[model samples]
Structures are given as C-alpha cells and as structure tokens.
Target: MHDTKVTTDVMNPDCIVIGYNEIDFAEHARRKRAEKGKSGGYHDLLTNSVLLGGERRTYMDLLNIVRERTTGCPSRLSAFELPSLGVAYLTSFLRRRGFSAAPVNSFNSATEQLREMLAGSPRAVAITTTYYVYDEPIQQIVRFVREQNPDVPIIVGGPRIQNLCSDQSPESRDGRLRPLGADIYINSTQGEDTLAAVLAALRDKGGDLSRTPNLIYRDPAAPDGPMLHTLTTVENNDLDENAVDWSYFDPSYYAPTAYMRTSRSCSFGCAFCNYPALAGPLNLSDLSTIEKELRYLCDHGVRNLIFVDDTFNVPLPRFKKICRMMIENKFDLKWISFFRCSNADDEAFDLMAEAGCTAVFLGIESGDQRILKNMTKFAKTDRYEYGIRELTRRGIATLASIIVGFPGETEESVKNTVAFLNRTQPTFYNVMLYYHDVLAPIENQREKYGIVGSGYAWRHSTMSWQEATDWKDYLVRNVNGPALMPGYGLSLWTLPYLLANGMTMEETVEFIKGASRLVIKGLDTDYLDPEPEIEEILRGLAAVRDGAGQGASS
Candidate 1:
C-alpha cells in the first residue's frame, strides 16, 4: 500500500492543502469507506454514496453495493487514486518558496482521514474547491476543521472562489461565505503567491489579512460585518516561475502520467463556453520552460502526459514547435491533448504521432453545420471528419465529444448529428445533454433560442431539456462506434489514465464496451433489482483489473 500519511514534520509543512475527489479514493480511505457501505443496488449506491460530495461512498462502497446485489461477489475492487494537479501545484509552489507543505491527494473526506491530517497540526489548512465538490462537502470539511482547532484559520479557494469574487459587497459576500465557514477565500487565477502570503500573514501579521491580494475574509470587528474584502488583483503567474513541483505527487499512484497546461484560458469564444470568461485572456507558457518540464517528467519515470491547455494546438505554429521540441528532445513519452480540428495541416498530425501522441480529445459539440454555426463553435463540420480520419489513420485514438441540445437544436439536427458520427467514425464517441449555465455566452442569447429555466432543465426554441436527455440516451444506445466512453469525466483524462495503469488500447476498448453495456442496462431499469447481466459484466471488469489479461467479450 502507498504511504497515505501526510509527512508534515518531515518537511515541517507550513500548511495543509486538501483536494476533494468524489469517486476516486486513496488506499487507506477505501476500507473505512467500504465498512460504512449499506446494502443497495449498483445505481442506488452510486447516486447515494458520497466519496466526498453528493452521496459519500468509494470503490469499496461500490463493492459492497454490488455484493448486496449479487450472490458470492468479491469483497473489494483495487484502489483508483489520482492526485489533483491544482493541489500539487500549490504544494510545490509553497515548498519551492521555503515553506514546507504536504499534499493529501485524492482525499475522500472520511473522519479518520481528517484526524490523520489534523494530527500533523500544521499552521493553516487550505481546501481547494476545484471540481466535483459541492456545498455539503465544503461545509463538512469546514465544520470538522473548526471542531478540531477553532483558532486555526481555514482557507478556501478555487473556481468557486474565483467566481464568487464577482460580487464584492461585504454583506452580499458575507451571506455567501457564512455557510462554508472558511476564514478566507482567494479569487486569483494564480493563488500560489496569495496563498503563501496568507500563510505568512497568519504567522507574522498577528492574523491580519488586509494586505493579501485577491482575498476575501471575515473580520467581526469591522462595522460592515464579519467579512472584510481586499480588492488588489494578483497578476497571473509567469508559467516558467510556477512550473509544477512534481515532488509532491507519487508518480506510481497516478497513471504514470501527469497533467500539464502549456497555456491558460482558451482562444476561441464558443457560445456555450464559460471557460474563456472565467480564465481571462490566453497566456502561453515559455517554450524553454515547457522543454525543461518535459525533460523533468521523462527523468522522473513518467510515461505519459495529458496537456490540459484549452486549445493545445491553437496558434498552429506554436503547436508544431512544441511537437518538434518533443521530437528533438528524444523524450520517451506518449501524450494526449484537447484538439481543434480546424486550421490543422497534415504535418501537424505526422509530427504529433512521431512525437508519441497516442490519443486526442476533440470537443466536436455538434455534427450539423447549422447547429455548429448557432453554437459559434468556429469549426467547420467537414474538417472534423478530416481530422478524425487523419488522426485515426495514424494510429492515434480520438474521442468525439458531442452536446445534444443547444439553443437552436431540433429533431432534424439530431438526425444530422447521428449521420455525421456514422460517416466520420471516430475511435470513440460520447453524447451529453446540454446544460444551461448562467455564465455561458448562450445565456446572452436565451431569448433568441426561446429559452427558459436553468441548468439541465433548460429548454430553447426547437427542443426542451427533457427531449435533449431522451435524445442523449437514444444516441448512446443507437450509435454504432468502436466504444462509447462516459461523456463527462471520461474526457477528463480517461484515455491516458487507462494506458497509464497498463491497459492496452484493445483491453481498454473491451473494458469500455462492458461499461457501455452496463450503462445501457442501467438506463432500462429502475436499478433496484439484482441483475445477473450487470453482475457478469462487473466480474469481467474485476478480472481485467486483476490482470487476468482478457476482458469478457460483449
């Protein structure tokens, strides 16, 4: 088992940073979570169990759920743990500045795990609310921290904090902050420096945080309320200066892979996108620094990389140069990226393959030209086929991501999407029901689409949200593809992850086929009954996971 304990005193870490993951669990937390599991069906366990948020359960919880649904099923599944890149960066940046910090990666927020971390008694505790975490989990973490050490300041920051900063009134901010119960919130794109300053302030400034940039905190003494606001904006980090400190992560615990961002923000402003607005303007990393980071990863025994840049191949010249740099370095690494199908030439594909690109994720969004235009995707429908064909022809895997409903979506448009998929034939495909985020550019044009409601319940002119979901289910069941990966988190780095854990492309495809079958079966039922078919599929995955070599044929 990997060392689950945070080695605080070894480095005398100045702060403890916690990253919350809902399903993935560290080895130590697995047994504890499973022991808490109750008898239930697979779907019930999945939705009701919370590894961190929503329902609190882990893989062991899943095993218990499955066992309850099947006779003589195994007691456990192998651990699936992956560190958070954001948390890793924060830890590394702190350590690099002479402040020791320990990272508790893939934490499931179990009470025992919290006790282990609090045992170190670090100066401050920082929680990153990046992705997949909700209010219940945040409140839980904050409540426990206060219970253990009321005086120790709890700091919270991430995408949520960045978004909340848009409203600056003390009363308005206090109303929002009162529930989570954090002492501070950082609203900066790069909070490494701001966080460091906050830690230093806690030690040196008698708990005064007035000077920290991009910060919002509560001060009961203030006449305005308990929350005091600091408005100084912190500039984005110089990529070269803030390279990920890989020392904080275990190369083996993750999928022999690392997630890197060569740039920040996205260049294109697709109508459905909120990333560009949230991330500000595009900022590219220095090429020399990029080369150095690649070399470091190679030296550290990392076998693969997932470039997290929003448009990794944008500004095609820079893209080609990065490819060429990887080639020139003679690095022994395979990579994947979020790709734009347009403005790409044959040379780029060739260069990517030669540089060891094993797969790519294309956010194709829509198949019909009309839908594409309405979404402001800025990609030609024809070029998507060309890109998929070229990439697949070169032995590279492609994941085609689609959004079912947009403002202008119609039944005919849905058929066109299916036709487009059948014609192009990517290595994998996934369909998602469109979600209406208030911050997305599409919100500005809601009346144009005759939209009402918000989030998943949203509807526009040609289709209602429920229709989109039904169509999504239809596409998943009806579409013919090599594999249908889960549309959401699967794109969140699944290809490299599968490969990183030693599954061959063929093996991975088989596993996905089994998962797809389970999805189909789950959709057809209320998911309360014990299903032999689903049970059989689970056994096949378990066999593959245990290195039995072959997956059960679908």
Candidate 2:
C-alpha cells in the first residue's frame, strides 16, 4: 500500500476512475478460489471446480466451443457485462461540477486505456469494486496505480469497503482499507451527491471533508493507520438527477437490451438480505422523470428494457403508476422486472403485461415454509405459486430466483422446493448458493438462524456446503434441465433482446435451464479460443449436473 497524501493542486487535476473484471477461464477460476477463502494450484482449482460444480458456463457454450474447434477455428464462447451504473453517476457528478472527469466504463476499456490515462498522471484515479471476486484484481490495479503516481489521490468505493466497516470503529475502518490502496474510502453513502462533495473536498488545497459521510481518510501522520471521519448524515437522494455521458457508453459494448433502475432498496427486513445494510431503504425516483426516460428510450429505437429495481413490485401505488404510465404511453418496448410475491396480485401482473412487460422475475428463495420463515421472507411457497402461475397463465414469462442453504434448509426442504418447481414450472429459474455477509442481519442473529462457524468459513445450523452443493446439483439435474433460456441463460438481463429479435418465451427458457452458467462477465474482444480442455471441464461438470458423477466432497 502507498502512503496517504492530501490533495494538491497541480493544474487541471482530473480523475480517471476505472473498473477491472475477469471472465477469462483462468482469471475466473482464481477469483472463485479467492471467494471460497481457499488457495491451491491453478489446475487443482479447475479440477475441483469441475467436480464440485458451481453455476458455470452454460452447456450450450461448451457445445459451441467444441463445434468451433472441429471446424479448426476458435471464437470467444461468451461475453460479460458489468454496467457499473454507480461509477457512471459518480463520474457524471464530477464532470457536471467543472472538474475534468473521465469514466473508463467497461472492464475491457479499462484494461486497454487505464495505463495511458495514468501515464498522463491525473490528479486522482477513482474506481469501484462491487463484488467479492473483484477485490483482489482491483487491489492489484490500485497498487499498480500507486507505484506509477505516488502523489495522486486514489478514491475507492463500493460494497467491499462497506463490508469492511462492520468492525464498528474508526481505527478498524482505517485498518480495513490498507489492503486496498485508496487514499479516501467512500465507505458510507454512495449517492452521487455524497461523492460530489468528497471530490470537491479533495480538489481544495486543505482537502475539506466536512460534508462527506461514511468517509475514511488516510492521514499521512498515521501512515498505515486510517482516521475515520464521521460526518452528519446527508440524504444523497438526487440519484435520479445525475445523467450518464452516453458518449462514454456504446450500446454495442454490452448486450443488446438497455438497462435502468427505477429505485433503490427494498422495504423488507429479510434476515438473509444485505440490501438494507448497503442501500438503506427504498428511494423511488420521481415518476415524471422516469416517464421522460421511458420516452427517450423509445425515441432512440430502444426496444428492450430491464428494470434493476431491488423490488419493482413493492409500494403498490408507485408500481401501479409506473405501469399505468407505460400503458398510457404505449411504449413498444418489451420489458422485464424483479418482483416480490407479497405485492404480486393478479391485477398487478395482468396490468404489468398489458403495460408491455413480457417477463417478471420473482425472488422465490425457497419452496419450504420453514426456510421462508427462517429468513423472515414474509411470503411463502403458496404465494410464490400464485404469483408465478398467474404470470405463466397470463402468457407473461416468469423466472424464479431460488436459493439453497438458508440457515434452516434441510434435505426435506430441498426435496420440497424441487417438488414445488416441478409442479409450477416457471419459465426459468436462477439457482443461487448462499454466502453470508458479515453485515447482514442473518449474521448478527447467529443463534436465531443456527449459524455455525464464523466469518468466511461459516455454515448454517443443519446445512453443510457439501450437502447444499449436492442438493443443488440434484435440483439442476431433475428440476431445471431443459427449462433454461438459450445462449447463456442470459435470463432477464438479455431475454428482452432475444424476444424482440424473435425468440419466443418458450424458446428463451429453453436456453436458460439445463445450463450451468459461467459466473464471470465476458467481453467483445471476445472471440472464443478453442480450448478443448475447457470444453472437457465443462462436459465433466455437465455429467455431474446431469447426475452422472459424485460431487467434489465425495
């Protein structure tokens, strides 16, 4: 890590914030190992991953790889998109403030452009690391930046720092960010409003941090130690006001569909969730502003939209108003939204489809009542059935996001959930393996949830990783096969493009199920190199997902 230096005015004092991600097989395998808090030989990780079998590259991806190889040529098997909407707003706010700010948007763009931008030696380089797999790679990037330009203020933000703040002390916050090389840690509030204040502070010679909240400063006097500066709470709710520099983003950089968020946070206090801890509570964007955005997207020939709301169906009035507006405007755009079963009445689902929704994603955490109650999910399997079935009956495709290994999950619970899936047959399903965050309510209620172990090694009261993995494997083989959407189980993220381009809902689901999706993001440089070994690894995992091989633990 580099020594902390206060912001100095060396002229224009620009900031180039970048984000680095990995979808390459080797890089992805390394990240998976890091996430498990385990380290071993590279080949060993690949072998173990094939045996243990987490959600990975879809079966069709492997088939495509093999087919291309036989033709004596290779191409990129897939593409991954990390839209980094947070970074967009942050940099946009800086630009609007008269500071020279550049957003190196995508992972691919960062890799190719960051070094050059750094060579110019901007006043500061800012970036966001949003996921567990991103931490190490981002750390390496930050370290490299420090080596080249020791004086520049490196601002880092995102969930990793927030997770580190669980220690609940200023010194701990200081200590936690040392591993990362950021000069200022935006650990508290991530609103563009908050970041703009921080940026303005840093640009001033004295480095005024008075207006910032949840900020950890690097005091050169302390060097290795941090001086956590706690400021009064600031409501950074102007999220919808910030506009992205569309010139920085090329539609071709990501999937065919356009993405936007209508709001932040969910009202629910589900034990297993980290949403409230991260984003606080629901902060809806102005409905009038959203309508203008919808019209703009429509004017631009944008045909597919994805609503990234934490709970798009909640707060029934705003939800209904948005739906009514979409209907009134008669947007030709086909869209998909994340919905909770509690607010999913038949009338809502029916109105949603008439308003241009082609698919609805439901977070059906489990089919077992006990597991649902264990997490304070508030909604039960019967409720999931009604909402999902209503969408299915209404010709609106449904995708159920399922999770295994909740604190009280059991063999019977797995069996019951699988039975429920078999009976309902939602258009598709997203099977997630549970990982506990230190800040989540569930972690605090260890006894309440029967959580065992501690930190990264923890497990639920009755469930072991091996047991959960095996059960997850069983569910894939029996319940999910052949029901997935084609071409990477792109799910709602890319399904609108597929539908708009001509694929039917049934055709889309066919691609999503039966496929073990590759977890990392992919790029367009992107031509798949025919790695028969990679294909063979995928085939081996497919056999296990198809119930042919014993899991890694066995």
Candidate 3:
C-alpha cells in the first residue's frame, strides 16, 4: 500500500481508470495453440489423460489453470467491441466533477501499455472488478500496477467489491481486500459518491480518508493495520446528469455495439440474487434521458445497442414508451435487453420487434413450478413458454438462461427444464451451476434446505454441488444443443457484438453451432483437440468481420 503524497496535479488527471474484461476461452485457446503449437503440454495432457482413463477432475483442473493464465489475452470480438460500460460510467462521472481522468482499455490492451500510461503518474489508479468473481486476473493486474507506479494509490471498486466484503468479520474482509494489493477498496453498493469523495480527499487533503464512507484502507498513521470506514450507502438518484463522454474512448479499439443501461436495479427480488441489495433500489432513467443517450450513441456511430438493465420490460408503461420513442425517432439501431416472462402483454412483443429489438434474454431460471416457487421466481413455467413462442413468431431471438441447482434441485426438475427447452425452442439457451452466496436472500432458509458450504462448492438437501455441475454439463450436451448457440454459454452479452460486426442472425447461429458441436464432442470423448477446430471457426468469423469493415470503408 502507498502512503499519502502531496504530488497530485489537477491539469494532468485525477486518476487513470481501467476495467477487466472476461476471457473468451475460444480466443484464449486459439492464442495458446499458436504460441505452443498442437504438440504442447495442453495436448499431451489431454492425450495422456484419455489413454489412461480420462479423469474428469484432471481435465477440469487443467481448464481452471488455463483460465488463470489467459489474462491479458486480447480478443478481436469481446475485448474491442464490448468494452466495460462500468468503466465508462465512472470515468464520465469523474470528468463531470472537473477531474481529468484517463480511461485505460484493459480489454484489448496489455499491462505494459498501462505501465506506459502510468508515466503520467496520475493521482491514483482506479480498477473496476465486476462480473465474474475470479480474483487471479485481478491479482495479476494489481501486481502490474505496483510494478508500474510503486508509490501511487490504487483504488478498487465495483459490485464484486461488495461480494468480497460481504462477510461480517473484519479479518475476513481484510484478508480478501489486502490480497488484491490495492491501497483503497470501495465496499459501497453505489460507488459514484463514495469514489468521488475518495478522489477529493486524496487530492485536496493529502489522502485523508476519514470523510470517505464505505472504504477499506490502511490508515496513514497506522501503516501496519488496515481500517474499515463504513456508512449507509447514498444512492445516486440523478443518473441523467452523467452522460458517457465518448471522447475518452478510442473508436479503433471499439466496435459499433454500445452498452447502455436504462435502469439501476431489478424490480423483483429473486431468492438467489444479491444484485437488488448491491444496487440499492430500482431507478429508471427518464424517457427524455434515454432518448438523449440514444441520440448521442447514434452520433458516435453506434449501430447496435445492448440495454444492460436488470429488467427492461418492467413497469410496462415505461417499456412501451421507450419502444415507441425509438420507433418515432426512426433511429437505425438494433437492441436487446433482459425480460421477465410474466406480466408481459402481446402488444409489447410486437412493439419490441418493430422498434428494432433483435433479441431478448429471458431469465427463465427453471421450468419446474416447484423449483420456481422455491426460488421465489413469481413467474409460472407456462408464461415462459408463451413468452418464448411470442418472441419467436415475431422473429426476435430468445436466449433462455437456466440455473441447474437451487435449494430444491432434483432430477425430475432437471427433466422438466430439458422438456421445456425442447418445447419452446429458444434461439439460444445456457445452463449454469448455481453460485451459492451467504449474503443472498436464500440464506435465510438455508437450514430448511439443509444448505452447506459456499460459492460453487455448496450442497443442499436435494443434491451436491458436483451433481449440479454434472447436470449442467449434461444439459449442455443434450438440451437443444444442436439448435442453440454455443461459444456464448458463459457470456450472453457478446451476441450483440456478433450482430453488429456484420454477421447475419442465421450466420451467427450456424457459426456458433459449429463450435458447439466440437464442445459436445469433447465432452463425449473426454479427449480431442477442439481448439484447432475452434480456431478455424474464429478465423472464418474474423474474415467476415474484416470483409464487413472493408465494405463499410468503401
């Protein structure tokens, strides 16, 4: 941790902000194959493991290692096209406060480039750690930052920070925060105010953090011990004031797909989710504000938009008005959003497609009514069927997201989920293992369900965590596997990037399906170099992306 210094220059920058992008395994695998060739440890391990009776644990262990080492791996798709909107939001907020901020592109760039940027020696370096909870990449990033600027303050904040400090014990929270190797950690739900206060204190008061609430930092006086400064979260009500400054982004480093959020939190509180708690409350952007942002995005050449709203279709009136606004403006843009299957009117679906909604992500957690009730997911299974069918008839793609294990998961429920997927025929579907969190509402009923352990290692009365994982893999192998897209089972947000990069919906589905087949084959054989096949598919897609680019330029 760095000490408080009086060397901040307002003209240079208040700080340099960066965000971690998720690793695209297909891209990672392709890079590894190029660097190591087809005859490396990765291939040898798989071949040897298969010859010696394939051990699933060994294969999984290797994959985990690959995920850890694949940090800083650039992607032509996710990295450049889908940059972190969280970083953009914070940077825009800081700039609005008259604090010059340099937003670093950590997605498609390397750490050494960050080292070059640190030559400016800004007041502090802020890193956004959200989405996946994997800390290995974060640890690597923190180490790189220290190497670049030994004495500069490092501030970490995001939804993931809330998860890291969720434990009531100070020691546990300190243990987690300290390992990230940052001078300051923001543990607030909404961090705009907390972060702004931190910057102001660091700059004007020589890093006096007493005024900054919701922070974990080492006291300047007591250098040996870390201190927690806690307070009630002050939510940001006026989101309209902070429009993203597109000037901070490099057009060459980004694609035409832009991510926008029309709301702050979800209206419903599902038992297994902690987002509602983290986001404070549900606050919708005014329709005027939404239109202004939409116009600004169009001016910046955004041909496609992805609304990162928790529930975009809720408070149905607002949803209808937004759709009508896009239609009235005649903006040449396609969009997508998360939709609740219930309480939706038939006219809404027609308006959605007419307003250029190419896709909708349905969080249909389960097709079993028993599991839905257990999850407090108010919507019925039948409503989900109707919603998907309605979207399908209107030519809108439906990505049905499924969770394998909740408190009451059973084989019968899993069967029901599979049957529902088969019947609805969603354009895409993904099954994920339940991520158990002690802070989630479901924790209140842990004893009733006989829940034990935490995170991906948890178990309940009905099944163990391993059973859930195995069931997840089974669903991937069977449940409409041939029809649904593959390469994006983990990251559904990347689908819009494909559409923006000049791939037709049919072409995108066919391309990902080809990759999905190899994935399924690997599961069946337990041994095979599908990465080489995956690399070929990516190469083809890259050509299409490039060809589209050349044509546009012409």
Candidate 4:
C-alpha cells in the first residue's frame, strides 16, 4: 500500500478529480439479496461463502452480483475494475499536460478531501459518474466545490452523463434532464478534448467555453439557463500521446498489470448496451500509435496490459495490424482484451496467441438465436461455438460473457444457454442479469424491452429497470437447472480454471476430473436442489470428460 502524504493546509492543487472507487465487496453482496428478495441471511451466506470459501468464489457469481446490483438497484457504483481503468487513463492524461492531477476514490472522506485539495486554490475540479449509482455523489461534489469556491469550474463526465448529453438536441429536453449543478457536462467520446479545454480555461482564468467539445454549461447572466456545445469526435487513431503527463500520475495503482485502451467505441449496437450511444460509433487508434503506447508500457516495466476496448477484435484488418506490430516489436507483455465472438477467426486467434494474449473476454450475450437477434448481437450460436472452440484449441484462454433475463428470455432459452456453454466449455464465463434502461434513447421505440417503474436512480437505493421484471424468480425458475446459463454459469466454472492454471498438467487434469465428478454427482442426486437440471446435463458430458481425461492420460 502507498502511504498517504500528509500536508497541513497544502496549497490547493490545480485540479482534483473524484473517482468513485470500489467499496468493500460486502455492500454489493447485500444489494444482490435486496434485489433478489432473498432473505437477509442469504446475504451473510453469500458473503461468507465468498470471503471464507477462498478458492470457491467463481467469476459467474462476481459478474452476477455486479449485474444484479447495478441493474436492479439504480446505484452509480460499478465493479472495481472498469472505473480503475478510467481513473488511470484520465489521471495519466492530466499529469502529462503539466497539471497536478490525482484520482481519488470516493470511499475516502470526500468532503474533507475536496476541501484539502481545494486548499491549494486550484482552478477547477472534474468528477466521473456512471449510469447506475454516481449521480448524487457527483452532484454533491459539484455543489460542495461551488459552495467553497464559486469561481472554480466543475466538469462532469462518464457513461450516464454522456448518454444524457447524446440525447440532447435542439428539439430534446435531455440536457435539462441532467442535474443543474454542473458547470459543464462532457460526453465520453471527447474526454481528451474536453479535459484539455477545461485545463486551458482554468489556466487562463476562464475563457469562451464554445471551443470545448461535448460540453454543456449555463450562464446565469444570459436568458438561456444553459447552452450546449458541439462535441468533438476524434478518429480512432487520434490519441494525443504528448498530452499525457506521467510524473504526477502513478501506474502502480493497478493490479495484475496496467490498463490501456487501444481503441475507443464499439461497432456493434446491441440494443441493451449504452456503449454505442455513449461512445458514438467504433474507432480504433492507429496501430503505430498503439504500438508506441504498448512499447512505452513495456519499457516502463508493465508486464500485463489489459485493453479496455469494448470490441477489440472488430475491424479484423486493423486488429491484425496491431497483432503484427506487437509481434514485430517483441513487446514482452501478456494482455487480455474483449472481442466479439462473431468477428474472431482462426488467423486472428492464431496471431493473438502467438503474441502472448492470455485471455479474450467474448460477449457471447445469449445462447438463443431469438434472444440474440432481439439484442441485435448479429451473430449465430454456431459462430460463437466455433470461435470459442478454435480459441481453446489454439491454447488461448477465453472468458465468455452472457446476459440473462432479457425481455424475451424464457425457461427454455435459459436451459439452451447452459447447454450451449456446457458444449463449448470456455475456460471461464460471466453471467449478467439483464439490465433494461428505459432512459436509453431507443426505449420509446422499444418499450417492450424498456424497464418499467421509476427506472434506476443513480447513487440511491431504489428499484432499477431490471427489478421491474421480477428477474430473481425468472432466473430461479427458468435458469435454475444444473447447467448454468452460458453467461451465468461461467462464474462457478472459473474456480476450476483458477485451480487448474496454478497446477501442473497432470495435476490440472486430476483436479478437473475430481471436481467434474463431484459436480456431476452433486447435480445427479437432487442434493444440490438449486442446480438439479444442471446435474442431469452433466451426466451427458462424456465429451467434456473425455477431453479433460485425454490431457491427464497424456
């Protein structure tokens, strides 16, 4: 742990950005029970199981908890991983510009912390808010800064703010939907432009805000309460390498490895996702620029790199270019990134594996074609299976993501998902409870998929759109079988992967056989009542057994 530097009445820094960091994992556990209508005891049981079970905690459960809590209860809180990336990038970007910037987690004493930072007579403050849980804290932070130093400019950005800004136009009231507290609202796409403009303005003691992209502000002296600016959208490869200052920002804040975003935005517009809306179309940074960035990290001793791109494998040619550059440079680093299952092919998989790609997180979405089509995933079940198997055969590990409780989800659909996952057998999986956003732009045209009730209130304990669907019962009834939903079951499946990865080949096979048998037998007898159907399916998993058995036999 890095020791906190204590300074008495320290001069206010130039800028302070508040990032809502991860609270303890227990709070999320409690939220899950609240959303599921499970008893209080259930929370303790889960917390105990995860905290005490040690090796028993599965990736599926972690993802499920994230989805259920973020969806069912409209809190701005998110899993610790994503926000850490955003903070690292932003902090690094700011420090490179010669600005004293530090990313502070919201778990600390926020008010006092702000007061301490502002003591330096800083020029401005920026804070991030996600869709579900951050509105209130961000608003409060804005208000606190305003009350303390009325002239200090405050900027807000994140998925929630970006969506709100994107929906705003001459004819729409979406801009007004945002809390009136912020001096500026920035969309996600123009993060660098907006931050740079804000920094420039602060240095000059304020200037015309019109030049800033993806910003909205209010001038009390003018009749119009607020004015919005044209947002700047950069090309995929247009990242400003010189704009980032690395001195004040620390890369050591991350675990496993440092995080980097090789590209911005997503090409696919899955109806349930907000990325296309918030990020505004797919864009890739130039391969040379990405190579430069990767080399910089490697030179700086960053051995693990996690690309934060929503769809890393899209624009197959560009992806191949990146792979080639990585291999050519001999960038001795291991990386993990997300990919659309439909877009990956044998060549791409081979290149990635050769370049030391450790894992690829695939957004498999759902196993049912109808549900997938409804979600606009645009890929068939067969394609997904082929991709997973190919990746596995090539010795590159895979993490499949699945969504459950979507509008068209049914008992049969959930079962099919589990069966599909069982057949493909990725090394790891993540199951997300469905989250319906009525506030999303397409909600009016897609009301059937829109979440009902007062939608989720960010940062507050309230019912979210997914909760309106009675998802717990739906999941319990429809996805209750022994085979986990392709997405949901991955959590539990990862435990064996983790154990196996740490062992020798022979030991790994033995571990898998013993675990698989125990799991199969548990499923067979009705002893594990919650997953009986899964047990029945396991009885038919002779192929899976043979695969595991062969490795052991060899």
For model 4, the stretches where C-alpha displacement exceeds 4 angstroms are: 1-11, 24-83, 95-98, 105-116, 130-153, 165-184, 205-237, 240-256, 439-554
lDDT of 3 by residue, 1-554 (tens): 00111122322568877777545444344444453332232331221121112332222223223233333443233323365687778777887787777666553354455666677667888888866465755666777778777888889888777888876688888877777778888887778778888889988998888766788887767756866566646667477777665555554433477788888888788999988977777887789989988887777777888888989999898999999999999887888889887968898998899999888888898989999999989999999999999999999988888888899999999989998898888988766668787888999998999998876667889998767766766777667642443323224566676666544776566555554555455554645654565455556655766777798899
Is 1 or 4 the stronger prediction by TM-score?
1
Better of 3 and 4 by TM-score: 3
What are the lDDT scores of the predictions, listed in order? Answer: 0.70, 0.62, 0.70, 0.56
| Whole-structure CA lDDT of model 3 | 0.70
Count of backbone collisions in candidate 4: 27
Separate clash counts for every candidate: 10, 21, 0, 27
Query: Could you tell me how far off, in angstroms, the CA of residue 15 lies in candidate 1 after the best superposition?
Result: 1.1
State the weakest 10-residue window (summed lDDT) of model 3.
44-53
TM-score of 1: 0.84
Residue pairs in clash, model 3: none
The residue pairs that clash in candidate 1, if any, are 13-100, 49-55, 49-56, 49-57, 50-55, 50-56, 50-57, 51-56, 51-57, 219-226
Per-residue lDDT over 1-554 for candidate 4, one digit per residue giving the tens place of the 0 to 100 score: 11122122224555666766333344544444565442222321231222212222333343344334424743222233222455556666666666666565443434565676665587677777742343554665666777777877777776666555554574353344346477766754557546766788768745567766556666536625545555555523256463233334334444225557766677777777766766666666777667776776676656666776788888888888888888989986777788777887778989998887876778887888988887788899999999988888878667667765666666677767877777788765545555556554335544444444322321112333234233333432333212222221232223323322232333323333323323323321323332333233234333456677797899
Instruction: Return the TM-score for each candidate structure.
Output: 0.84, 0.79, 0.83, 0.67
Best of the two (2, 3) by TM-score: 3
Q: How far is each candidate from the true structure, as Cα RMSD in Å?
A: 6.3, 8.6, 7.6, 9.4
